[model samples]
Target chain A: MDHGEKRLMDKNQESLFVRLIPFFERYGILLLILIMIAVLHLLQPDVFLSWRNVTNIFKQVSWQSMLALGVFMVIVTAGIDLSVGSIIMLSLMGLAIASKAGMPWYVVMLVAPAIGFLCGMFNGIGITLLRMPHPFIMTLGTLYIFRGIGNLISGGVPITGFAEQIRVIGNGKIKLDVFFGEGAREYIPTSLILMIVIFFIFWVFLNHTRIGKWIYAIGGNPGAARAAGINVDRILIVVYTLCGFLAGIGGLILAGRTNSAYPNAGLQSELDAIAAVIIGGASFFGGRGTVLGVFAGVMIMGILRNGLNLMNVSVFWQQVLIGSIIILAVYIDVLRRQLATRT
Target chain B: MSDNLVLEAKSVSKFFGTITALQNVDLHLNKGEVLGVVGDNGAGKSTLMKVLSGLYKPSEGSLFFDKEKVTLNSPRDSQNLGLEMVYQDLALAGNLPIGDNIFLGREPTRKVGPFNFLDHKKRKQLTEEHLAKLKINVKSADQKVEELSGGQRQAVAIARATAFNAKIVLMDEPTAALAVKEVGKVLDLILNLKKLGVSVIVISHRMDDIFTVCDRVMALFQGTNFAESELKNTSRDEVIGWIMGKKD
Candidate 1:
């Protein structure tokens, strides 16, 4: 490889870029988040980095992060779950309806994720057993089917919730009375804590467990994984089920925060979750991604939306921007893959 | 049949509805012997390999391990019987590092309480030792399998196949697309397996590879046995004729 004349010619040019961006290959999104924060702070001055504003950003990012984790798992196995946003709305409706029907708060709280797991199982079974050409067709079909059920169940109206535990998990914050002197009232958001905990547990699951490696292997090459005696169908089912389960969690949090689950809730939120996963550097082609990268991706989206608000950017413009960033992130993934294989 | 034979496939036939992929294919490998299988394209070479590896169920046949009747219902069943296959595509996860790929199905775990976590240190140590023993040179066992050259990828595949104390290895065109030097290395690996008393059945189109490492040769032509010979009693020209449908 070194003997190639082209290698010599490119070495001089490549050295400069390599030297300037040593960590750029792996931690590129983290760097992007930092730069975005810096620019936002510069443009908005006092509003962008204030204590309340920072906490608010984290609060906004929390539920989306959960959905992204689920999507990350599915994407790692080289599959997609466009039904996650739909999964959230359907489960949240179930939670609200159950809570409203005189069921205990604890039961409904646990029920939300349970509903999600079942929905994911549907996706998994449809993809693997039904022999769908690809997961996209199956999940896309469910994206409509699940949302329609939510619409039917909720009668296309909002379902109000009245659970204290739900509200606490979604909206409560632990105040630092002694440190902040009560009047100052600085605190850490519960949603933030939940996000970190969920992310940590899943990071361990994906990196340390044999099942985790098998997921990556399936994504890397399904044929090879099967040839190596790994159960490809079972793993695919597990991944989709996990995605639905997390979407259920996201729905629970979203409903808890709002104190209601609307029939039309989570519209296009799945796209946002997918955007976050892509921005975090998970390849659509699969077999590569990190939880940290996806976290950074969630932050990038959260900050971008918040920063746009602070800078007086139009809500419509933010939608355009976020969609464009998803495309850009995916394009970068393509380029990264090319670069990896080239050497 | 010999007492030393490690594996045998008797009267194996495979059918895909109307098409017969294999018919009455008899194959055997003795302990510590390298048997080369040669055939042209669509000559049931890969099909037989797949059947032996339990990727396919033979329409009619029986397999034997150490002269005992056995059934390979799946890759795991074959694996349980110590039958390992080094696939043509290498069956490696390109996104994973060498150590991870080498230990994909059977990863070492450190039990912390009731939960088990992959023991990265032990895995890396063992991978390094295995690669070193195989003379596979790379910067680190942590290097992604995709980052390696064709030869290096082949080395990783071979390292993985031979790692789990496999009694008999089935390699499908192991040296097909490798470099000249890499081909030599693969032949050496085959010999190394023979020295360890492991049986090998390697599929190849190259007579040079068979002559270099194989103790005997077998040929299949359009899903049936064409010829069989010990290397000492046969010439390259005769083996080439066998692959070209010659008999006796």
Candidate 2:
């Protein structure tokens, strides 16, 4: 190529790079996650690449994934549900008490989710009808209230002796015997399957449903949403309620996995779930995120913890690393938004 | 002409905790007429519009639409009665696509079994059709509102108001932030709405737009009707005098 032609091509490439900057900012987390996986595999190939360990990671993160999904919706509406962890603990406590009362296992399952829905409704009502200035304060208040109730009910002890059927919901695995030879079985945790199914349902809802669009619209600009004839208060209530309901489901899975419902179960879980959602790509300021992005986010956290554990990294160091990643994720989001506005 | 009046407000007053935003204001809008509302910053132009659009209920007095007495409790109530407002802020969700913003609350949906899903194809087609009919020069319906220029965002907001079959459209400072050329486009849009026989109540500080588009001008001075006259009968100086509380 001639010198002028080469310079012209270089200018075109430069412009193209500028154009792709926003795209990179958006999916950079996914890339970082892939790089982390590669690095972990390089560090401990035998342990990290094992299917058994991979499935274990998925099982470990499934309940947290559920909580993240719920938090994702709430964040998308420009709200936060700080009460999620407490709601989960409270729901599990209700399940434990019900099971101890000799209620049928199926009935307890139904009751647990019902308790969760009501708790969510309480948050919703407190914010919507009471006209709370911000959901942060509302949910934060409920967080303490619900946790206090949980502690009171459980008397600061664990509730055990759950039925085997109930236990299977968390610990059971679906084995693919047909696809593998003897002793080469692949097992998928039931909870993981449930999480995936819930994710799929929410993906369709957020993308294809009117309420989902309203959630984005409200989050993007609530004054506009109201002026456009949307019932902003109603949608906000629905979102917070759903967040609580999902937290209830997470509580049930936790109870099943441990075969007990401890008063302090799911403590500080809200932070992890919020971190996962933010790390996935949802903006803390709201009106931006995708369900797929959230799944990727949950996976990133799962992989990070698992990789660190495999490396025998100290728990303190893991906390520091995860905290740094959260700050990095939010900083990237801020930069992405700035680029978006500029373009 | 009086029989053709589409909306009439009689002695409407709104007070915010002893602060009278609007006091005993009387207004009238005729069919297919562009009525300009001119006022100073605190002259209660926006307050009056809010009452007409049902954002706030009047502290006292009643509204009449199509010669019948009525009450509007909310924006939805006004919208149901074929009245719509293009707020000064434009009220467009920046993150949403043009089509979605245009049909944010009133999206078309298709039912599958017991579930309802957005009919995105229909929405896009209708958005395109509306933009074309209104001659709004935007790239596509799928383009996000944030990506559009100021004039284009205003066009989308206007298109949204018109697409819902509003008989009376109230606009607040529609040309306040537009470039000179873009301001011309918005003025032309108001003319087109008039051609379609839609009544328009435009609140603006730009006297040129009022002269170019409004049929009759209403001036408010400190929340009261300072002057009301036909555009041809009133001059810019006279309107300015009314706004400045120098003449009534």
For every model in order, what is the number of clashing pairs? 0, 0
* After superposition, candidate 1 runs with Cα above 4 Å error: A1-22, A333-343, B1-3, B11-24, B56-62
| Residue-by-residue lDDT tens digits, candidate 1, B135-181 | 77888899898888788898889889888889999998889898887
Question: Which segments of candidate 2 are over 4 A away from where they belong?
Answer: A1-28, B2-4, B10-26, B56-62, B179-181, B222-224
What are the C-alpha RMSDs, in order, of all predicted structures?
A: 4.2, 3.4
Give the DockQ-based CAPRI class for model 1.
medium
TM-score of 2: 0.91
Per-residue CA lDDT of candidate 2, range A1-343, in tens?
A: 8999999999999989977876776677778878988999999989997888998888888888878998999999889999999999999999999999999989988766787889999999999999899999999999999989988988989989798878777888888776786566688788888888999999988999999999999989999998876889899888888888889888888878998998778899999999999889887888989998899899999999999999899999999999999998788678766866774
- How well does each candidate superpose onto the true structure, as a TM-score? 0.92, 0.91
